[model samples]
Target: MPLPLYLLALAVFAMGTSEFMLAGLLPDIASDFGVTVGTAGVLTSAFAIGMIVGAPLVAALARDWPMRPTLLAFVVVFAVAHAAGALTTSFPILFATRVVAALANAGFLAVALTAAAGLVSPGNKGRALAVLLSGTTVATIAGVPGGAVLGTALGWRATFWAVAVLCLPAALGILKGIPAGRGGDEATGKPALRAELAQLARPRLILVMLLGALVNAATFGSLTFLAPVVTDTAGLDELWISVVLVLFGAGSFVGVTAAGRLSDRSSGPVIAVGGPLLLIGWPALAVLAHEPVALFILVFVQGALSFALGSTLITRVLYQAAGAPTMAGSYATAALNVGAAAGPVVGAATLGTEAGVLGPLWASGLLVAVALLIALPLHAVITASRNTEVQR
Candidate 1:
């Protein structure tokens, strides 16, 4: 892989840390801002909303700009937003900072993925994406827990400051390492917005986007309520919660690594196999949630399957939208965030009923099943079409 790709990963690590660390700081933010925990939690929603809205908007607007400059500008804005967040005590101001930071984050990721895809040959796109996504998995394992510890010891403001400082190295790396105007579709002229929009409007691309959304909804819906599930269903102590989460993160790392290699051979097989694994794993989790040993094993497997599927699904989208790689990358980001935002709502609603912890697992499994049903036929159609073309 290119050095710039790793630099892009570093930038992604910073954004991922900022995206997830808020969960650990929510309590502190509530206390400091004199608001309810639920009110402080709105900051997360604000961030996701920004991602869903900002990704395509920014990608569309900046499609013709040089990749390095666009990425650097977004990172600088992200750092500034974090710095502002660190200084703000007012709830509203802090909330606005989260939204702005998320917009920058979304824009950066869209460009980074597009650039990463362009850095390598067609056969290596999946692996390149895997390298880029490893940053997020690593963040879940280290950065999020570290931020929680930092918040507990130094306070939430200190954590924000730490994230702000973290962006400097990434910004500098992007500025110095990434080649200018290399990955963009348009080098000397503006991107054809009508053509990009037309590509995005394809039914196959829409199906892939739906697949992305459903898969994320399946994984995140249960994951959003993992703490409650671990405690309520498995009868585990609170301390064990961290252990389970760490195992999940480890699984994600392993899965994405495997996906990088396997998806290079073909995204179709990976998606076909991994999607069913998720469908199987979720229901097994639901059934095994009461059995501590079984539940722990299942959670790790589920995490791996979820992330592996993510890489493959994105590869599939790239394949379908070969003409609009950057816009397609933005669409994938937005779809995942949409699912991320919705999953929690579904989980929360389910928690209120008789089903309790198991509801999310079941809901997630059903969504995955729907996705698999859609994906298998779509893959078949694409394969058949390709075969027909080859024979001609």
Candidate 2:
């Protein structure tokens, strides 16, 4: 990988840390603001909303801009949003800042992926993209854990301050390092983002994107409120909760990397394995939440299997789409943001039930099963279309 890839990864690392840190601090924010934890979770929901809205909007608006200026603009947005988040004492202000930060996230990732792909020789594009996205994977493994510890010790605000500080270097790194006019489409007279939107008109493509949304909803719907669930069910302190959650992040990193490889080899088998494994693991996690050791084991497996489906699903979408790969990418990303938005809302609602800690997990498993059912026919579709090209 090029040095640019590492530089982009550092930027993504800061962004990922900003995004996931909220989960660990939801309780703290709630307490400080004198709001319910469920209410404080709106911060995450706001971020997802921003991603869903901002991804295409920014993509469309910036279609004509050279990638360097566009990405640097988004990086600045991220830094400023984090700074605002760090300074705000009011819940509404913090929430708004989170939303703005997430909007930056949407644009940053779209540009980053495009840039990463462009950074390398045509044959090595996939590798570049993978290396760039690994920053997110590393963030999951390291950033979230670090944020949780920071939030617990210095207070939640302090964690956001740390995130803001990280953003400064990330912004500068992006501005200085991204090759001028070398990122995104410098040829074909700049593909209009509106052209990409047309790809959603394909039914199979749309189905695959929706599938990504549903799958993520299944995982994060239960996961968004996992801290409280662990606290109450496992009788663990905040510190222990953070540690176990890190185990979950560890599982996710393993799952994402392994899934990417598995998809390259066989999509059908990967999804088949992922579906049942997630179905079994999620519900088991719910049952095991009462036992800390058991819950840790369950979370590890849950993280691993749940995220393992990502690359497989992305491959399926792109394969089915065939001719319109860029549109397929946009759809996949949009679906992901939609899932992120829906997860917390669903989790909050589920937690209100009498089943308490176990409710969201059961609900999440049902969502996964539904996703599997949707995916079952995808194999036949792929066979009929013969569209299984390697998707970036």
Best by lDDT: 1
- Please, what is the whole-model Cα lDDT of each candidate in the order they appear? 0.77, 0.73
TM-scores of all models? 0.88, 0.91
Best by TM-score: 2
Q: For model 1, what is the error of residue 244's alpha carbon versus the real structure, in angstroms, after optimal superposition?
A: 2.6
Q: Where does candidate 2 clash, by residue pair?
A: none
Stretches of candidate 1 off by over 4 Å are: 22-42, 87-92, 152-157, 181-191, 231-239, 290-292, 382-392
Q: Where in model 2 is the C-alpha error above 4 Å?
A: 119-129, 183-185, 189-194, 318-329, 382-392
User: C-alpha displacement of 1 in model 2, angstroms?
Assistant: 3.6
Instruction: For candidate 2, write residues 187-305 as lDDT tens digits.
Output: 56544555566666767777777777887877767767888877888888888767876887888778777765655445567677778888888788887789888998888888887
Clashes by residue pair, model 1:
none
